[model samples]
Target: MKSNFKFFLAILSVVFVFTACNKYEEGPMLSVLTKKARLTGDWKVEKRISASGDVQLFQTNEVLKINKSGSFDIFVADSLTRFGTWAFAKEKEYVYFTYKKEGVDNIDEFKIIRLKNKELWMEDTEGVQFNYVPA
Candidate 1:
């Protein structure tokens, strides 16, 4: 009976550790892949939701590629539109990007709502949510 109680306690502890490790609002529960590995890929917007309603992007095609080297590229209609450096901020809760435009530097950030192997969800400062899938 003592051994059984010990086993139960061990299981409970394991469960707590895994659940506590999840940092995102929407979560994977547990992931073997590191954050950078999971984020390094080509992703396209699957949906966009704003305070008003769902929005349809004007571009026929748009892709955002995040590299393992901390660089990112945004392509619109098969044309390179933006290139930048990206990093995780605020304990990995936000994705921060820096780029140059008109010879000046610009910074943008997105709060991560969910991050998984196949799906990424982020919300902008304007309360717009973007859902991305592997492209």
Candidate 2:
């Protein structure tokens, strides 16, 4: 009877342990990549607005590649160039990122306006708007 109680307790303990464990993980940084993060692949520029508020449609092939490995790339006129490593900027009201190339030591930041199904929109502080669609 005692052996039976011990076996039952052992099974109960196992069940309790399994049920108590949680699968979700919280990021340590304030700039979190939530489950809804959609900027994870290649994209092509469809529209761009300069600081002058002049809209320009993409004439040549301009592409931006966002990688899961914390890197980004730019393709212009069918020529691929390493943009550099990318990371979320400081915890501001909007989502933004800062990136620096291999040769340049300056980090450029852009504020994201929209990031959803097949589209991405961002702008620099100077109000240069950039819109992208899935490539």
Evaluate all candidate structures by whole-model CA lDDT and list the values in order: 0.90, 0.67
Highest-lDDT candidate: 1
Candidate 1: tens digits of C-alpha lDDT, residues 1-135: 999999999999999999998899999888899888888899999888886887855333899999999999999878999999999999989998899999999989899999999999999989899989998
Report the lDDT tens digits of candidate 2 across residue range 26-116: 2121223542356678888889999888999986577788887777888887787547777765443233334555655766677766656
Over 4 Å off, model 2: 1-36, 92-102
Question: Once model 2 is optimally superposed onto the true structure by TM-score, how far is the C-alpha of residue 116 displaced, in angstroms?
Answer: 0.5
Runs of candidate 1 exceeding 4 Å displacement: 52-59
Taking all chains together, the TM-score of candidate 2 against the true structure is: 0.62
